[model samples]
Each structure stands twice: as structure tokens, then as C-alpha cells.
Target chain A: MTRNTRLLMSMIFWAFIIYLFLPLIMMVMMGFKDSEFIGFPIRSWTFKWYQVAINDMEVLGIFAYSMTIAISTTILSLIIGTWAAMALGPTKFRGKFILFALACLPAVIPGIISAISLRIYAQSLDITPGMWAIILGHTVHNVPFVTLVGIARLNSQPESHIDAALDLGADNVIAFMRITLPFLVPSLIGAGIFCMLTSFDDFVRSFFLGGYEPTLPVYIFSQLRTGMSPEINAISAIILLITAALGLSAERLMRRNKKKV
Target chain B: MQTNDSTVRLQNISKKFGSVVAVEDFDIFIEPGQFVTLLGPSGCGKSTTLRILGGFIEPTEGEVFLGDDKVTKIPPNRRNVNMVFQDYALFPHMTVSENIAFGLEMKGQNKAQIKKRIDELLEFMQLDGFGDRKPDELSGGQRQRVALARALAPDPKVLLLDEPLGALDAKLRKQVQIELKTIQQQTGKTFVFVTHDQEEALTMSDRILVMNEGRLEQDGSPKDLYYHPETTFVAGFIGETNMLSCSVKKIDDDYVVLDWQGNELRGVCRSGTAKEGQDVSAAIRPESISCSAKKPGNKGVMKAKIIHRVFKGSFTSLSLEVDGVKDCILNATLAGALAEQLGDEEVWISLDPDYLSVLLR
Candidate 1:
């Protein structure tokens, strides 16, 4: 309430931010170090470590593979989640709460538990441990987030919008396509970005379900066991920068959309 | 052959939600090119009836027809009627031109025709430069006009409006009411509007259907309802009225004479058949009471003292208490500025018998 209290609070908040970013800052700084082994005394810094990761053909391949899995997961979850949202948008039947909870259950489940269960499920179905398996695991995890965002956006939409479309001589399908789909575009895009980020950053599921071919996260994780190096730090710093940029933009979009409606 | 080209016809329509009766045994027939309004208080089934006409709500029991076709089983999209919702419900994602072009697109109009219609509607609504703006970019009044333009683009058999101007301020509402009436006339479209504002109903409707508690209380013109309300609810709901209890003395060919406080007052018998020496209820508009400084020897003149005078912008309202009345007061409105001499002064008040509505108890 007072100036002293405000000053103290600001200091505390900055301290918390610094604590949260200390490791990420150190990791990024370590990528510029010329030393083979990481240490605080940066007597010299070079671009060789960054060049090593950037020029590595295997790292580049893993990046593309991870992007493919993320895209696939996003597309699958988007379809399933939007349908789930539309089905639940205006319903008032009994068991609706249970149905909705089941749809969102994967998001709250432990990631490792889901990873083990998905690997087992894939095995029982005789689906090999590979890209399909990893994509399936990522989609199951990402769908709940997509559905949650989609439902919130859909519910906030005016019921009369659909009615207006129908009154304008649009059939039900046409109304959804013309009115409802456009209305949901912003939220679906937000959810899509979120799915890609989460699927790209995912490690446990890809580790359990991936084949000899590895995604970027799984690949980085395997490289970590070989021993932590400046090149590994460089790759991680690039990933951190990417996810941070995507997350900040998604948040800004949601805030702007919130103010609009 | 059964339908006589009525734009909309509802026969014995009723809707029950669980134990609640939303609309019961309602029947209305709307002629083409007429501006009709369903006027009632909230929860009086006026909106339900409008929705039923639009094919958005299926009546529990009834037949709905748009012109000669029975459309009771049809959905809203297939029906020949469209609605301007209370909130306007403009598509936020679409620009003004896109919104106006939507119905035309659905009508399968070519791009050229759609473009022409959009331009025409934009100019018609006076939103020419605002064509590329989204709904959120426009003000409330602009959004409302955009919604109206969208509904009108389809050229439907009937246009239903559910209190579309209920969201506007008083000045804007009055302006829009005139615009709506003008548009209805210019387009030659049958418009069935729903509203609780009696003033709005009177200003726009060619015919007004007064409803109360799911029943058709009265169906007539604005002048008819205002001058001769059939029931006490209709009398009170439409405008300010003095519901005075009086005894009918005798029924003339045109007017019924009633005895109020030892004076004989004449009132029109509009509700039911009048009887001799029977207790009755009559509705008298305050504006109908003529105030005189001098005691006039009129048939129904009453000496009253002005209890309070409220100066409304264009008129002054005077509250009067009759000499013989107990614990009761009557109201009279004097137009324009009045001299202070008439304030809080005893004056002779006479009722215009033609404006007095008599009802049987």
C-alpha cells in the first residue's frame, strides 16, 4: 500500500524472475564459452560450439523430424478437440460434466504414466515404436489443452450468431462453416501453437515411443548422456529461445482477444 | 387455397416448457407489407410467439404457414422468415459489407448482384465508408443497422424483430423507430416486431397485438389501444391511466353515463355490454382532463385542488384531489408553459368522455 511496500514487492518480484532464469541464462552463456568443459571463468568465448550444432547434419535432421511430429500432433488434436468442443458447446444433458472431465483427463495425468501407458497401448495394437507412436502420445497430451481453449472460446460466442446464420438461409453445416468456424479461428490458432510447443518440448513420451530415429528433444537428451558439452548448451539455448518466443506471442494474442470480446 | 396470401399465419399455437406455459392457444395472421408489433411485458410470450413465427421455436400444438405453405415442421434455415435479434447478433469476424452480403450469398446470388446489393445496403444504412469495418469497429447503433441490413438482404417473406431497439438510448431508439417504419414501408415487407415499449409500438406498428400472460388481451391499432383499452391490464400497461370505480347510470347509443361523486360522467363502453345502475371500472387518460380556472357548468365538472405540479420538459403534470374523494387523487396534464397562478390552485376539471374507456367489473 505504501511506497516502501511497493518498492519491496518490486525487488522481490525481480529476484524471483532472476532465480527462475538463472539456469537458462547460464546455459545460454555456456554455449559461447570456448572451453570444452563448462565453468564460470569464461577466459575465452568462441562461435565454434554454436557452429558445431548448427552445422551438424544429424541435429538438423532431428529438428525437421521433431517439427513433423509437432505438426502431425497439432493437426490431429485440432480436429478432435474442435469436434469435442462443438459437441459440448450447447449441451445440457446429464453426464456432461463426466464427459468433459474425461476429455480433459489426459492433461492432468502424469506425463511419464501416460508415456508408459501409451507405449504399452501401441505394443498391444502391434504399432511399432516410431513416429506414429510418438505422434499419438503427443496428440493425447495436447488434445485436452486444445479442447479447453476451444470450449472456452465456443461458449463465449453468442448463441444468436448461429441462429442469425440459420435465419439467413444457411443450413446447419453451412452455418457452422460460415459463422462458427470463423469465430473459433483465433482460439484454434492459439491452441495450435500451444500444441506444437508442448509436443516439440516433450521428452518422456518420445523417449519411450521413438524408434532408432529421434526427435530433437530425444536427440538432445541422448546427447546429454554422452556428456554435457557447450554444443549441447547451444542447441538447448536455441530451443529455449524458440519456445519462449512462441509462448509470449500466444499469451499476447489471448490477451488481445480477451479485451475484444 | 386455404391460405389467403397472409405472410405469416399461426393457428392455435402453444408452447409449454416443463410446467411453464410460455405461449398458449395463440393465433395470429399477418398480412403482407404491414408493420405489425406484438406488444407485451416481459415473460408474456410475445417473444415466444415471434420465435415461433420465425420457425426457431416449434409450437407445442399448432400449424404455421408462410403464405400458402404449411411450415410447422420446417427449421429456421428453410423458413421464409428472418429475425433481428434483441442484441443484433452481428458476426464480429465479418466486415459490414460481408455481413450484408451473407444472406444474398445464401440466396445463390452471383458476385455482381451481391456486390450491388452490398453497396445498396451500405448506402441505405448510411454505412458507406464503414463497409470494410468489422462489427466491433462500429458503434452500437451502427451494429444494429448492420444487422438490419443483413436480415433485409435476403428479401424474406416476413421479417421478425425481437425488441431490436431495446438496447439503444431513448433518443437513438426514437430515431431508429422512425427509420424502421420508413424502411418497412419503402421495402414493402411485412415486419412483425416484438417490444414491451408501448410508445415504440404506437410509433411504428400498423397493428399492435397486446398480450398478457400468454393470452391475446387486445389486437388493434395504436390509436384504438391508446383511446379504448379493452382491459385494466391493457389500460395500465399501455400508458398512464386513472382507473376510477364508478357506477353506470344509463347507456346511451354511443356513450355510457356513469355517476362519480354526485356528478354524471360519460364514458365509452368498449369492454362489454353496459347495464343500468351497475358498478364499473373506467380508464381515463390524464391528458384528456381539461382544467379550467373558473367553475364551468359542464355535465361532468368536478372541483379539485392541485396537490402537486411536476414540470416535464414539454408539459406540466398536475395531481388533483377532488373535494369529495377520500384518500384518492387524480392526474391531469397541461401542455406547454403554464402561469404560476394555476399551480396549487383549485380548478374545475372536466373529462373528455370520448377518451374515457369503460369496463365491466
Candidate 2:
């Protein structure tokens, strides 16, 4: 209530805000710097790094590959995760808790461990490590998030809606498609965006399972090892912008669905 | 649209969930165009019985018949029945017209026919011009009407309603009760309504089925159940009644003499055997007993002291204590004006022999 306390609270709040955004701000600023080095007082500003990054055929190819894997991962996770959530949402069965915990194991375990274990499993199955393997790894990591969100959405829905649908002459498949699926749209969209972002930003799993074909994140990591460059900063800024736009659109869709319901 | 064989028959239906019996040996025959109510307290199997009729759940034992067809193992979608849920379960995302058109569309009706049916239902339910509004945009009573319209759109043989007006306010509920009965009469469909409210059942149903503890206690016309209850449960459940324990002094073909606190009172025995010298209970409705400040020269008149008088607008309920009636309290419904004159004074109480329901304990 005191003036000093209010000032101190505002100071701490701004410090926390800066702690989160300062790195992002610095990366964005470095993307515009003219110098090859990433840090220090800016001598000049230019879009040369962005141009170079966009013109590099290898970087562009890696970005396209990452987009493909991320999109595939999102689609696969959405289908499998929504199905699992629907099965587990409104019923009681033996070993349900154990099954849920096992489903969530990949999300909670260290990513390095899962990546190594998956590589070993793939090798045992005589499967080659490539884009498919990376996509599989990303899906395992993202399905649990989708399932959790889906379960929360499904649990909040009233059971009588489905009962009413059936009582009004709808078959089982029709009831699910009309009532249950519509009710789950907002959560599905949100979870898809989350899974896509997670897959696009993932590095460790892609590095371990990607073999010769490097994704965008793996390519960035390799560039970092060579030396920090403005081109890497440019790509990072672009990824950040895409993710922010996706998050904003997801929120808008959720609000729109809320109004409809 | 076949109205002749629209009767619903349930033969020896029993349902059990896990170790609990939800309904046991339930049997009833609902004739076409009859408005029957399954009345009971919460968790007393009324809703369960309605659900069984709707084919939402299969009874563990017994058969369900719609017209002449056996439908015990049929799914809900295959049955010619629809239900208005307790919560009015209108789809939140759909407009009122869309919700009403759902069943008709599922029946393979053309778009034009569906639209025409929906318009008719909307007008019938007094929900005209609200068809484009979603459920959340409508009031509770409006949503309930929409739910009813949706269920009736397909013109099924039977319409089931599970406490459909439960979420409305008192005034809205009363209005809906009258509207619901009128609609059922107009549709000429067999309506199976479920509710725990006795007054609603008495006001709306042509036949009332009283259930207690997952078993049917009594089933008859409203007046029949009220005047001739077969058991103590039915007497206590149907309406307000004062139960007085007495010993049977003598038994006749039509009436029985019960000795109540050394006073021999004769009442008609409508159910159960009346053995001489056996203990029994008599259920007398409060409205059947007349109370006067001065002693009346009537055959069944008894002197009792007024313990308390509760003024309930239309009628005053007088709680009386009679001499030698040790553990039993008698209640009489007197006019407010008459009850105001007899304050803390001895009054004469007369029991109508015809209205007194004698039951064997």
C-alpha cells in the first residue's frame, strides 16, 4: 500500500518482463545488424543477412523439410490424441491411471533419453533414421499435450448432449460427429497449433534421429557451432514471428468458438 | 403416423447396475394418447424407467413392447421414441430450427419437409421467430420448449419427458405444466412423463404410477391413488396425510371398525385384508377432516386440542392433540377464517369415512 512498496513491485515486474523478452529483442536487433559478429554496439543496419538467409538453397530446403515434418506430426498427433482422449474421457476402466501415465511418459522424460531410446528402437526394427524417424519422435513428444488438452475439453462437456442426440434419432456415429466433434473443435485447433510449434522448434530429437537430413533447428545448431552469424539471428526472428502469429490466431479462434457455444 | 397401435407395454422389467438395483419387476401398459406420470422421489427409479422406455438403457430382465413389436434389445435410434431431457439438453451450437430439424433430417426427410415440420413445431411450442437463436441465447423456458419441439419433430409413437421443467422458476414451471398437458392432448401421442413433484403429477397426469425404493407402490387414476392408497408408502407419498395407528375391532364386507384410543371409528377398507383385533393404520387427508370451535353432533366427531395453526393463505393447517392418542398427532385443514376463531381451544374434529384410507400395517 505504501509508495515505496508499489515502486519496488513495479520494478520487479519490469525486471521479470525484461528477463523474458531481452534475449528475443537482442536476437531481432542482431538480425538487422550489418556486422558479421552477433554482439556489441551496432555500427550500421542492413537487411543483407535476411537476404542471404532467404537466398541460401540449403537453408531454404531445410526449412521446407522442417515444415513438412511439423505438419505431419501435428496431423498424426491430432488424430491419435483425440481418439485416445475420447476413449478415456467419460469412462472408468481398470488400469486407466497407469495407461494415462504411460501415454504422458515421452512428454515428461528427458528428451535426450527418449531420442536415444527411439533411435535404438528404430535400429532394432531395421528402420533407417531419416525424416520419418524425426517425425515419429516429434509425434511421440506432442501427442500427450494434445491428449491432455482434449481430455480437459471433453470432461467439461455435458454428457446429456450425446444422450439427447441419440434420443433424437441419431446413430452412434452421427451423434459423435455432430455433437462430440463440434464440441471438441476449439481444443483440437489449440492443440494442433501447440504441437506444430513444438515440432518446429525441437532440436535434440531432430539432431539425434534426423541422420543426414537436418531440420531447421538442427541446421541452426550446426551453424552455431561454426560461429554465431546474423543469418542465424534472421531465421530465429522469423520463426519467432511465425509462432507468435500462430498463437494469436489460435486465441482468436478459441474466443470465436466460445461465443458460438 | 400409425396411431392405432401406439401403445407401450413393459413386461416384468428389471435393471441392476453393479450391485445396486435401479428398478425391479417394473410393469406398466401405457395406452395411446394417454398422459401417464411416473412419480417418485430422487433415485427412486422414475428416470430409469423413462430411460428404459426411450431405449437409452436395456433392462437386465424382461421385455419392452412398442405396439406389437418386441424392442428390448433395440438401440435408441431404432426405437420410435424420443425424450426431452431433464436439463433440456439443447445443442448449444445449433439454432433452435436446426435442433428441431435434427430428428427429421435423420429420418431421411427432404429439406423442404424438414423446414415445414420445424415451422409447425416452432409455432406449436409458441417459439415462433426464435428459430434462428442458439440455445444459449434463449431463456430457460424457451430452451425447454425448443427441446420439446426437437423431440416431437420426428413424430415418434411415444414421447418421453424426464422432469423437463425442473430448471424453470415456479411460475414458468406451472405455466409449462399446463402447456405440456395441452400439447400432449393435441399430439395424441403416448406421453410418459417422469417427475418427483407430486403436485405436478396430480395436476397433469391421467394416470399416476407411484414408485418407492425402485418398486411400484401403486398405479391408478389420480383420484384413485389419493382416495384408496394400498400401502403406507403410497399414502405418505401421494399427498399430505395424517396417519393414525389403531386396532381393528370388527371387519365387514365394505367397512371396518377401528378402535382409536378407545373410540371406535368406522372407515371403508379399499385394500388389504382387515382381520379382527389386528393392528392397522388409517390415512386421512387433512382436507377431509373438518374442525369446529364448538363440538358438532356428528357420529365420527372427536374432541381434540389445537396445538398449532399454520396459516397457508388459502387454508390453515391445524395440528391437534387428541385425548388418549399418545404418539400420534392429528392434522386438519380448516379455512383461515374458522382457524382464526379457535385459538388454543378445544375443537371438534370430524373424519369423513369415505375419504379415510384404511391400510393393514
Candidate 3:
């Protein structure tokens, strides 16, 4: 290709990226306005909205609840996913295809269907639809995604590693903990962050299963029903900032680990 | 009780992955302090047999006895065997000292003892100052030494090595092979190695088990396997040999007359199993055939023309095709002086029947 074609392609790529971020830019601009309602133009800039969201006890409680659900979902999914992947990835057995299909069921199924099924099951078990329900539903949707990342990481690992460890007198558990686990650390972190973000931004499951409790996404949706307020914009801005920081940190950590290895 | 020459024995061992037989009814006896190599081409059950001996896989059929103890069902963690994998398999996360000390730590050795053993092994492997370096930080040869130290730290009954130096460059591999042999001699541990390289097997092994298609073709000392291969497969696998089809003309008690390409060649039958009017293939090493520009009044000289010449340092290989005989390649080491005038010239080649191996057709 000519230089002009390359330059035009790069410009188009940047344009696509900017288009993706246009809504977030608008949200942040709307967040800083001192007006009672969010609009296109920011007439004034103030810290009052930030203070409002930071000081609201009810909103703080919801944030705490959402954080608890997100963190628990991430940890539980990582454990289940890593274990399931390790058990099924390297070993050969009968019905391996069936096991793989079952493991992928969660990722292929629609999230809302899983949410409805979870709500039905939880109701039958006399477990009320609340924070716990959201945790269970998010786990159902995120575990398979985490398992896929774990499987890819495990499959790329050399089989000689486990054999070497065993030859060095390490049992199965010791080999997994010492050799396999450390090698999977970067992918583990990557998968955990992905699960956490998936749970954090999920709305349909939280909307269907949550009862008398609001996750962050549900809370944002409820705020949209009422007129858009600067306090809500401020919360959105804080969430956006947190996600960007987390993404940058994850990338930086992966790079550092790669270099260290 | 033979205390010094105790052997590691495998009895009717068989392993199958589903229906594919990786190792089938294999048996081997490795004497103590002997360097025995399981030499075969890839997928010929050499590494699989090594892994089975190392206790990484339970045999599907029979038992393993190490100095009278049955160990077929023993796990790799409990077996007194350590393996150096093809890629070295050094722990990328651990320092050289930590990697070497791992086996000792697993055996519940005290930290002080572990440190001392690690230090001694480091010194022995000439990696004394590289204790703190990770496997990736060190060079390929250094990582291999660390792997050796780790496997040797526990002083296991058998040290299993799976093509350990296969990943190195040719020059480095030769140097490390010498160092490994020295280490094996100093330690006097039973070394069970696996490789497909013919030269490596010839140089390193006290005894070599030649395998093919999951079956043991032949097993003997290096000289035994090299000088007298049991079958055509063993003959071709062990070294470079020209296997020529011949019909036995007359077989006396100690002598056999062979008709090859309408030429009657009188040669001694070492094992003397040839019957009269039987077909057999004779394995003749290239170096066994001595070539000269003029007939030297030798017993079995054949008139042949040189087709091609390959100049190897310190030696030369001449490809010869006779008038009524098939092409025969001859290798001679005394090159610049003896065979210089015979290049591209009609030559008479002499063969010693003592170096000939006859196998059934």
C-alpha cells in the first residue's frame, strides 16, 4: 500500500476510537456542571455534586453492597473457573467433549435467561432476591468467561512443567500450587478483572433478581427515571475513572510480569 | 546378594493411552552405576519407557523392581527417580539454588542441609555463582546444569534424562555431553537416558537398548550392539551399514559361501546360523571395505567405479557402483594420504568377513 492509504487507515482507526469514547466524554462534562439537571453545555463548574454523592448515606450503602457482590462474584468465579479448567484442560478422559460443552454453557446462554432461571431457583429455595441473588446470577454469567481465559493459559503451558515438578518429588497438589498456579497468575488476574467488570456493569440480571436492593447499574438506571442530576453524573464520572485506572493497572501489571519472566 | 551391581528391572511393562499402545510389554535391566540409554527414533516408545521407569505413568501390564522392591504402582513423587526433561523444565519462577533445593526440601531435609547440597551441586556443575539467577536469566547450557543439579540433588536410585541436551547447539551439546558423563562417573548413580541421536548413544551409554515401534529390537553393551546387531532394523538403527541381499551358496560348519550380484564371496559366519540355499542380507560397515587403486592381492576384492565422493574432515566417503553389483558406499578415515589417488578412479575394494553381519531374509 501507498503512504496515503496507510495514513487514511490510521485516521479512520482513531476516528472509531474517538467515536467509542464520545458518550463517556459527554458524561464527564455533564458531571462537572453545577446545574440541578444534566444537559449538553456545562454552564458552571462546581464540587457540590461530588460532595452530594460522597455524603449520601443511602447511595454509599448501595455502593458498598455493589462492591461486595462484585468482589464475591469475582473471587468465586475465579476459583470455580480455574479449578474446572485445570481439571478438564490437560487430562484425557471419556466424555471430554461433553464436559467441555457443559463448561461452556454459562458463557453461551443469554444473561437474562440465566437471571430468570436463577430467580426461579432462588425463590424455590426460599432465598429472597437481593444482594446474594445478584451474586449468584452474576457468577452464572461470568464463570464460563473466566474459565475460558484460564483454559487458554493452562493449555499454552508445557506439559513438561507438571512432569518436571512430579519428578522433583512434588505431589499433584504441590505441583499445581507451585508450578502451574504461578504461571497462570497473569491470566488469572486478567480473568478476575474481566469477571469483576462484567458483574459491576451488569444490569439485566441485577434488575431481574434484585429485590429492595440496588446494584450500581440498577441505581444508575433508577436515577435515569428521575430527572438526570449532577450527583448521578458525578457517580458515573467516578466509576469511569475507576475502570480506566483498573484497565491501565492491569495492562501495566501484565507488562511488568512479562518482563520479569 | 550382589551389592555393588544391583539392577533396576522392568518386567513385562505395558502402557496404553486408550487404545494406542505407547509402550508394549517392554522389559529392561539396568545395572547399578551403568549409563544405559533407551535409543530409538521419535514415537518409538523411548521417552515413554523412560517416563514409565521414572514412575510418571503406571504400567498397564506388569511390575518394576528397583533392587527387589516392586514399584510399578508407586507415584512419581514417591519413586526414587528424577528426570531431566527434553526442555530442561527448569522452574522459571525459582532461582537456581531454589530449583536445586526443591527435591531436598520435599524429602523433608533441613534448610541448612538443602543449602549445603545445593552449594555442592552448584560447584560440581560449575554453576557456583549462579545460585540466585532464574532459569530464564541463565543461558540454555546453564539451565541444563541447574536441571541436572536439581535431579541429582536427591541422589535417587535412577536418574532419568529425556533427550536432555537435544535443544543445544551441536558444539555446546558435545561439551555438555562430556561434562554429564564425568558427573555420572563421579556420582555412580544409575543413569537411564533416552535419545534418538546415534552418536550420542554410542558415546554416552555403557549399554544401549535399541527400540522401534514400541518394541525392543536389541539390548546390549555399546560394543555389542554396534559390532553385532541382532536384526536388520538394529543394524540400520545402530550405525551406518550397507545391507545387501545375498543367497547362501554352501554352508560348512564354520564357513559360508555367499553369492552377491553373481560374485561368489567367501566370508566367515560369526554366529554360523546360515543354512545351505538360504537367503540372507549382509550388513557391512562402510569402513570395513578397504579400497585401493591397484589390487592388493586381498581375498575379497571387488572392481568398482567411484560414483560420488564426500569430503569429511579427517575422512572421506566414496560412493562406488560396480559393473554387475549394486551401489556400495565406503567410508575411510585415512584420507589425504591413502585414498587421495583413488578418487574418481577405478578401484578394487577388499572386505573382511569378520565385520559382516548376516540376518535372515
Candidate 4:
């Protein structure tokens, strides 16, 4: 790349980094503000909001609800998505292209469409739009992301290694567990973290299907309507910190795996 | 019948992938403790047959025997065979020691025994002090040695190698091929090696199974295949040959009258059938054809013009244009007598019928 192009790209990259991290940084700063209103450029610092966030029963309930849904969505997405990817990735089958295309379509489509369509479908089945419905919506959205991660991982694996493993004296199941699964661990972990983070931070899908129990995103949305509070800022700060940690660890795990390869 | 101490038997084995037949009616007998190579061009059934023995694929129609047991239905891991893959196929994530210990681990051997065998194999393969490194961390030759150590670490009844040296460069390939043979001999394990390179096959194998188009063209010792190829494919594949399309005129007990390019002459028949007026193809190796500047009238001399000479280190190969066979070119290697240039000069060619392998279809 030319120097001009490199300079332009570097500027754009840092600009995007600033744009993504600025809001979280501001929210964290606002969480420490002593003033009643959680705003930018705080006049002083205090720990009252952090204290309130830890003790508030309603906020704790919302956090617990989101955590439960995110975990469930992550686990379910990984199980079904990994199964789908392995079925379609390595082996040859009729209509394989069509099956793969359909499997990947949900992640690209807008979440509102999936959530609203799932809400209608669930209502028709006489299912109350609750934790289950929200989970279903998040799973529908997360499956494609998980499947893509899984397929890429599986594709990167040289099929010869598995064949060689089998030739060496491993049965089908044993070969898969010994050779294939160990290689896939990094991608599976990465996909699981992504699924959980998406489900946790999700607002549209949770807002559409979450009926009785409010997810943290929907709770944050409700808190937004009541004007910003330092407790909300403190909670956002905690959620951001947790997601950032997951993102970093997942990235590090995949990088370590790549280094081995 | 266990007639020849055959450790592995493939009977009329055939494999098809959709419309393409990868291996067809391939029959091979691998003797116990023998180093046999399946030599062929790519797309031939050598590797496929190896896979069948490794139990990686089920033949479309055939049976495979390991000792007295039929292993056609057995899965690869369940079979008593191990393979050193073309790319080595060492697990990237595992250290060299761990990679070698994999098969033993599958056998449920305890850590102490696995470690002991791993060390022994590493030492035997000359890979000591390198167990902690992963496959990527090692050089190509090191990786190859590690792969061999891993395959041998399991103490398999049969060791199958599919183009084991194909990934290495020329120098490393020769060194490793000798190492592989020595290891096989020391271990006294049955080795079924596959390679497309005929020279390597000739050097390494006790018996070479030459294949073409998914068919076993010929199976014999390197000397036997080199001197007595059974088919046109084997003659052209296993060694260099100058094929001349000739027709038989009369067959006798000792020799036969052959019509080559409208020139009637006498040639020896090595084996099989030859009838009067039967069309046949004959092969002569370059070294078999004796070239002379002056015409020798009496024996088996055919007229030829010297087209060009290529000096190949120890020998010079002369490309000659024969009379009445416009497109037919004969390659003759000349030593002391006919080594000098006889520019565009017509020379007499004498081919001993005893040395010529007549391939009859």
C-alpha cells in the first residue's frame, strides 16, 4: 500500500475504534458521576450509583433474566448450529448448496423480521411470548453466525487428517472426537461467545418477543424512556466490560489455535 | 489357501466413484514381512487399493483378507494396519511425542508404556530430542520422520504408506526412502508402499505391483518387471522402452519370423501365444539395442538413421529414425564402440529376441 493510502486507512481504523468505544467509555465515566443525572463531563465522582446497581432488586432481576436467556440461546445455537455445519460442510449431498444457503440466511436478515415473524408464529401456536419465545428468536438469529463460524473451522481442517486418523485404527466416532473436535474447540468457543454476546446485547428481538420478563436490553430501553440514571450507566458499564472480556478471550483463543496450525 | 504366506490378499477388488472406476478387478498378494510397492501413474488404483487394505473404503465388489480373517467389512481403526499419509497427517495441535502416542492411546495403553514406545520409535527413526516440537515447528524431513515414528509407534501388523516421500524434495526423498526401508526391515513389519516413481519402487520394494488405469498390469520383482514386462503399459511404465508395432509371420519352438515395417526377420518369443500372421507389439530397452556404424548383415540388424544424441552422464542416448517406420523412434544407449557421432549416417541395429519382451494383448 502507498503511504497516503496507509495513512488514510490508519486514520479510518482508529476513527472506527473511537466510534465503537467512545459510548462505553462515556457511560462508564457517567456511572462514576456524583450528580443525579447521568450525563457527560461529570462535575464530580462517586460510588453511590455502583452501590445502587448492586442492590436494586429489579435491576438484578433483569440482569439475571438476560443472563439466563443468553446462556440458553448460546448453548442451543451451538448444538444445532454445529450439527448443521458438520452435516453440510464436509460431506457431499444433493442440494447441499441450497441447504447451506438457507442455513446462513437468518444471520444476514434483519432481526426485526425474524423476531416479528417468530412472534406471530408462536402466537398462532398458543404459545405465550415469554422467555421461551425470546430465546427462540435469539436462537434463530444466532444459528447462522454459529454455523458460519463452525463451517469455516471445519473447512479449514484438512479432510486427510481425519481419513488418516481412521486409517490408523480409529472408528468414525473416535476419529471425530479425537481429531476433529479438538481442532474445532477454538471455533466452537468463539461461536458460543458471539452467540451469547449477541443474545445479551440484543434489543429488537427481545423487545418483540419478551412479554412478562424483561431482558436487560429491553430493561435498558425502558430505563431510557424514564431519563438516564447512574444505576443504568453502572449496569451498562458492567455489561460492556463482560462482553469486552468475552470478545478478547475468544479472539485470543482462536489466535492461539491459528498459531498452532 | 494360504499358499504363499500371503499376509494380505485382494481378490478381484473393484471400486467405482459414481461413473469413474478408480480400481478395477485388482488382485494382489502381499507376502508376510515383505516390502511391496504399488507403482502406478496418478489416477491409477494403487492408492485406492492401499486405502482398501487400510479399510478406508469398501470395495464395490471384492474381498480382502488379512491373514485368515476377512477384513473387507472392518473399519480402518478396527483393522490392524497403520498408514504414513502423503502429507504425513501428523496432528498439528499435538507435539511430536503426543502425535506418536495417539494410536497407543487409542489402544488404551497406559501413559508409561506409551511414553516408552514413543521414545523407542523416536530414537529408531533418529528423531530424538525433538518430541516437544509440533509438526509445524519441525522441518519437512523431521516431520516425515515423526510421521513414520507415529505410524510405527502403534506396532501395527501392516504399515501402509501412500506416496510417503512425494511431499519431500529429491535429496530428502532418497534419504527418507532408505530410512523407511531400514525401519521396515528392523521392525519386520509388512509394508505396503505406494509410489508413482518407478525408480523408487525398484529400489525399495522386494516386489513391485505395476498398475495402469485401475488394473494390475504386472506384479513381480524389480528385475523381473524391468526385464519381463507382461503388457505394453508395464513396459512403458516400469522402464524406458522403444515400442515397435510388428506382426508375426511364423512361430517356431526357438524363435519366430516377424515382419517389422515390411522387413521380414527372426525374433525370439519369450512367453505366451504367437501364431502365424498374428499382430503383436514388441518392446526393447535402450541398452538392449546394440548400435554399429557399419552394417552387420547376418543377425538381427534393422536399418536406422541417427536423429540425435543426448549425453546422460554415465551413458549417451541416441535417438534414431528407423526405415519404413517413419514415426517410430528407437532410443539406443552407446558405450565404447558407437559413442562418437555418425552424423545422419545409416547404422545397423541388432536386438536380441531373448532380451525383448513381446507384449501380447
- TM per candidate comes to 0.96, 0.94, 0.92, 0.87
Candidates 1 onward: DockQ, in order = 0.81, 0.81, 0.77, 0.64
Q: Poorest 10 consecutive residues of model 3 chain A by lDDT?
A: A252-261
* Backbone clashes in model 3, listed as residue pairs: none
Q: How far is candidate 3 from the true structure (C-alpha RMSD, Å)?
A: 2.7
CA-only RMSD, every prediction: 2.0, 2.5, 2.7, 3.7
The complex in candidate 1 yields a DockQ of: 0.81
After TM-score superposition, the amount by which residue B249's alpha carbon in candidate 4 deviates from its true location, in angstroms, is 3.4
Order of all candidates by TM-score, from best down to worst?
A: 1, 2, 3, 4
User: Model 4 segments beyond 4 Å from truth?
Assistant: A1-34, A38-61, A95-102, A105-109, A116-133, A211-213, A241-245, A248-261, B1-6, B262-271, B293-298, B302-305, B322-325, B336-348
lDDT scores for all predictions? 0.89, 0.89, 0.84, 0.85
Predicted complex 4: CAPRI docking category: medium
Model 1 lDDT per residue over B1-361, tens place: 2445547888899999988999999988878889999999999999999988888889899999888889998998888788999999898888889888888999899999999988898899888899999888888899899989999888787889999998899899899999999999998999999999999999999999999999999999999999899898889999899988889999888899998767688999877798999998889988999988878875778889888888887898889998887766898888865524463578888989999999887
The alpha-carbon interface RMSD of model 3 comes to 0.8
Question: What's the lDDT for candidate 1?
Answer: 0.89
- TM-score: which is higher, 1 or 3? 1
**Model 4 residue pairs with clashes:** A169-B77, A170-B77
- Off by more than 4 A, model 1: A1-7, B1-6, B249-252, B261-263, B275-278, B336-344
lDDT of 1 at A18: 100
Greater-TM-score candidate between 2 and 4: 2
Instruction: Give a tens-digit lDDT track for model 4, residues B305-355.
Output: 888888777778899887887678889888734576454568888887777
Docking class of 1: high
Ranking by DockQ: 1, 2, 3, 4
Candidate 1 lDDT by residue in tens digits, A1-261 = 999999999999999999999998999999999998987899898989889999999889889999999999999999999999987777588999999999999999999999999999999999999999999999999999888988888888888988899899899899999999988888888899999999999999999999999898887777778887899989988888889999888888877777776
